[model samples]
Target: MPAILLLIVSGFYVGNTVLAEYVEKEAVKVPLEAYLKGHETGKPEYMQKAFHTDGKLMFIRDGNYTTIEFKDYIGRMNGQPAKDEANRKRYIESVDISGNAAVGKIVLDYPNARFVDYMSLLKIDGEWKIVNKTFNVEPKNSSD
Candidate 1:
């Protein structure tokens, strides 16, 4: 009787663990899809959907740390696809989730530069929203 109960309890736990992983991955992908759409369409609305209103973008420029609020970045969108749309690509590399928090990495390739972005997200009000992003950009043809 004791062995049978143990087996049943163990199976339940295993099933729940698998389900949790699947749920987390799918949830994390929601914001990423929105992010990709924003870049592809050059629409600020898509970016607004993917990120929290107060999200911040951080990077280093000329040996100085710089930060841009999401609002400021969205203001620069031109509402048209980039001129190099033919050469543009965005790829989601990986995502790791713990409870309601997650981190994701993606690569963006443009005609003039390549960027790898690491985003931090939180599941808020039943939806995942990007809270922060840090990225490294390499200009095309740069020797470094």
Candidate 2:
């Protein structure tokens, strides 16, 4: 009975220590949120550090949709003015890891627009990078 109680207590403490709350500290979390902010801040170099060379990006606007090469995406953003990049921000909501694959959900924040998306990650060369994403923007609530 004592042994079982000890194990239960230990598990409870460990779970609390992992996720913030209930007076726990030193709990580690994924760095996806930081990277998202880095990308939004126009630090492509920092953003690139998290992506594989073959990373691909897909976006939709109006009635047209397209997938763009990562290199081209970076190149196009390189010389653009700051205002153009302001609407481009992603907030990573969660990350789940299973072996070499991870699934992440992010919320895109734009002027009068928003989206919740799921991105699949593949670990290549010991680093996790986005491989593909399936997403759709949320329809605006006219009542707001």
The C-alpha TM-scores of every prediction are: 0.90, 0.62
Candidate 1 per-residue lDDT, tens place, 1-144, comes to 999999999999999999989988988988888898999999989999999998999999999999999999988998898877887899899999988999999999887799999999999998899999999998997443
lDDT of 2 by residue, 7-125 (tens): 99999989976664322111111335534654576666655655566877777868678787767665654533357465555666776666667777878776556777676677676
Tell me the TM-score of model 1: 0.90
The per-prediction tally of clashing pairs is 0, 0
For residue 15, what is the lDDT in candidate 2? 92
**CA lDDT, every model vs. true structure:** 0.92, 0.62
Stretches of model 2 off by over 4 angstroms after superposition: 1-31, 59-65, 79-90, 138-144
